[model samples]
Target: MKTAVLITIGDEILSGNTVDTNSNFIATQLKEIGIKVLSIFTIPDEESAIIATLKKAFGMADVVFTTGGLGPTKDDITKKAYADFFEDEMVFSDEVYEHLRTYLEKRNRLWILDHNRDQAMVLSKAKIFLNFYGTAPCMILEKNGVYCFSLPGVPYEVKPLVKDQIIPFLKEKLALDSIVTRIVSVVDIPESILSETIEEWELALPKHISLSYLPIGSRVKLRLTGTGKSRTILEKELDSEIQKLIPLIGENIIATHEDKIEKILGELLIGKKLTISVAESCTGGELAHLITSVAGSSAYFLGGIVTYATQKKIDILNVNPRTVEDFTVVSEQVATEMATGCQSLFKTDIAVSTTGVAGPGRGEDGKDVGTVFYTVRIEGGEVTSKLFLPHLERLDFMNFVSQKILQDIVSLLIKKNKSPQLY
Candidate 1:
């Protein structure tokens, strides 16, 4: 496989003030075209650091990509570093200047062209790729048969440069193989046992195919990746292997395609023609957010309510005040009532509810941190579950509970016919 290295140059990233999302995005784009990212380095804006990292990156991989330190300001010294690294001198490019002037004039900001004119300066040996989104141009240089692409730090600019320009250039220049992958999401099973159950099938896999077990919350995703010269053949090979492995754990498999639980839930709801809503407490609308994160969720996601206070739960959801007074707010009884009330209020086919204590401290009712009770009411039947995860922090607890709730919803829908209670 062709290998590449990614270098992120920014003191803000090293200081944790700015997140390095460019490396991840660029690496993913490269992977889709069959380039394997070997290593990633995050360094400061210092010219010495840039030159040193470039040397290391070029030595490590066939291609090197750098993001950041391309602005007009003095701290943006990547251009100077590139000149020194390539033993070249800086030269003004009228082509780049005209592009910049036209770009700014179109935005009615041509008066500031002189102030940003330094952006038109380029290394004499470098090839310039115009930046339609921003002032800084993408520069490419070669050293000892290795290519390095320098890009601006802004994500918006980096995205188009990598996706629209650099990726096509690399594809045309290199002879690359095709890589295809499929994700099988499994639930209600432990990773070790699941692996052992499929060990026979896993060991019989072809050399070009690989499997990875990714455990998130309460679900395990089996990623089957195949690489070859032909994408069609690889996909068929992967599907064949999955069919062989299905009988081993078919009951545990929730989805054979989608990687995310929310997407899996969305597909099931849409396929079954079901409408759903949520009543969130300690989970605090996280369930709704996850559901709506999918495109076209409006087809099944009717609405949501976040009844955080005890009074709102009682007044709005019509939770019996006596139930909370007797069992506290974070109980299974309250969760069931909330789901029933939400289903009635929204008139959706399915209503989900969460009542939990996600906190650095104990809940108001003295319930320990990370105590959650969630209910999924479908039609006239309901299922309520409880989880106590004191090991997780507040945010993590909330997220885990929300993910588990969605996963359970998917599971219930899949087994709705088998289970008479859900009908």
Candidate 2:
């Protein structure tokens, strides 16, 4: 496989003001054509930093990709840095200047700043790839069989250049193969124990196949990647290897693709022709947000209620006042009541609830910061409740709790579908 290195340049990215999503996007697209990204470097817009990183990237991989610092600003020094590093001079390109002029004219802009005009500067020895999406042109420089591509930092511009130009150019220039990947999502098992249980199966994988473990919250995704001359053969092998995991792990496996818990839950609901609703407290309707994020969720997701205050839980979800008085707000009794109330309110086939103390501080009941309780209720059937201590910050805590609620509901549905007894 051809290897590539990505360099993302910007002070904002280093200072946490901006995210470097370009590298991930580029790497995914390149992987489809059999190129693998070896490393990624994020640095400030200083010329020296850019030069040093470029030198290192060229030395490490056969191809280098850079995004950022291409705009017409004082801090945009990537062009000069590349020229200086290559011991070449910046030459004006009439073709690029005329393209810029036409671009500005179509937008009816009469005034052209010198900085904007200066975007036509090109390294004399580099091959230019004209950017129709932006003023700054994309350029490729080759040294000792290593190719370095410089592209605009703006996401919109980077997207067009990579999809329309960079990828095609590289595919034609190099003999590349097809790379295929499959994801097997597992839950109900801790990552360490899951690894140990599957250690033998993992060791038996084919020579061309590699496995990576990506853990998120209570779930771990086993990603199997394979490279070969034919995508069909690669996919078949990956699928066959994934099938071996089913008998080994059984229902601990949630999906054969990388899907969000809410999405998987939505599919299950749709498949079973069931409708659902939610009642939330500390999670604050985040469960609703996740459910509705799926494209066709409205068919199964009836609605949600956020009852942060105890009185609202009583007045809206009709949780018994005595239940909260006896077991407190973040208790299993209240969670069960909330789920029951949501089922009655939405008249849905299933309902779920979240009552938690997700915080930097304890709740009114003096429960720990990470204390959480959840309940899933099937209409006219069973009600299940559980407790989880995620111990995460506010946002992460909310996200994890929402996923847990969906996962619980899915597990309930799976059990109900497989059991001899309806209840």
Candidate 3:
């Protein structure tokens, strides 16, 4: 088993201007290659500071990953620090200089095109990673039988290089097996109930496996991880564990594979040739956004209505004004009416609606914050509405309400066999 350490090099992270997401990204990729992360450090991108941290990191782990400070900025100092720490000579390389020249010419930053080439040369004898994104390239240097890689700070560049390049390289060189993590997402149940319900299964989990509870808003995901094995073996064990747990949790499972509910809905609607629409209020346009996020959604998503205000709910979605004044917009009567109204208006096969008091504030009848209503009307087939109470702040209340509507649509599709529904 190899131990890994991540060093995030930036002053901005230390100053709290930017979060240090690079280290976690690196660690996650490393874990997939069976490299256990032993420690993580966020340090100033100063020559001495980085060198000292690298020394400590090398002592604790087999592979060290350092990100940030690898751009063509004066404050970016990773390249200098690594060269000094390794006692490696800094020499101009024709290959790196040429790369910088062409890249700058293409981007048309002619002001310092030649100077930028000079800035990009890696430490003499160090293997260079031609960063496809920025001027300061990632570099790798080996010393005393340990491995170190310096990577770019930009997320788009670092993510692919680390996940696709760095981890695969290490796996091959070190003869490491892939580590895999699987997620089972569930909804409509609070975390406390979920914890108590699965306490025994959790305690009985194997030493080779770890079950982590990730509760985000109204949903709870069970993440199962198995490290230090081939991907097939890890997946087999994970599947077995999830199968055993599923029967126990029964109807609580919403979906497998950790994907969002909207994604699940999109697939189902597209596959079944089922068109859909949305009538929304408290959740604003959240349901529509979730559906559209999946490409090819245009096939099934005809259009929808946004009835946030009382007049729009009445005139647009045809929710009767009396319904809002009587049972209120957040009530089940209004929810059902909104779904039916939108389904008819859009002429789609289904309509999902949301109306509620997403409040740290008050509603028509002083409905509490987090009071949400979700409805799914499957085009002249059936209408289902449920009162949803998601844990959320009033200002961000629409987020949870929006998410709940998406979730319900997926749930209906699965039940109808357009998609496979979980418990």
Q: For each candidate, what is the lDDT?
A: 0.92, 0.86, 0.78
Number of clashes in model 3?
4
Q: Candidate 3 — which residues are off by over 4 angstroms?
A: 270-273, 304-310, 325-333, 356-371, 381-396, 413-423
Candidate No. with top TM-score: 1
TM-score of every candidate: 0.94, 0.89, 0.84
Full candidate order by TM-score, most accurate first: 1, 2, 3
Q: Decide which is better by lDDT, 1 or 3.
A: 1
Better of 1 and 3 by TM-score: 1
Which prediction has more favorable TM-score, 1 or 2?
1
Q: Sort by lDDT, best first: what order?
A: 1, 2, 3
Candidate 1 per-residue lDDT over residues 21-72, each given as its tens digit: 9999998898898888999999998999999988888888989999999888
Candidate 1 stretches with Cα past 4 Å from truth are 105-112, 417-423
Candidate with the greatest lDDT versus the true structure:
1
Q: Candidate 3's residue-wise lDDT over 1-423, tens digit each?
A: 788888888888999999878777787777767888998888987889899999999888889889888666688878888878898877888877778777777898766885576566678877776766667666777887788998877787898777666776787778675678887888778888889988898888788889888876677878888875578887888888888888777577776675676776776677678998888787777778877888888998998767878788888888888888888777888888888888888888888887777765677777776677777878566656565465666546666667666776666666666336453
User: Which candidate, 1 or 2, would have the higher lDDT against the true structure?
Assistant: 1
The root-mean-square deviation over C-alpha atoms between each candidate and the true structure, in angstroms, is 2.6, 3.3, 3.5
Task: List where candidate 2 sits over 4 angstroms from the true fold.
Answer: 93-115, 125-135, 382-384, 388-390, 419-423
Estimate candidate 3's alpha-carbon lDDT, on a 0 to 1 scale: 0.78
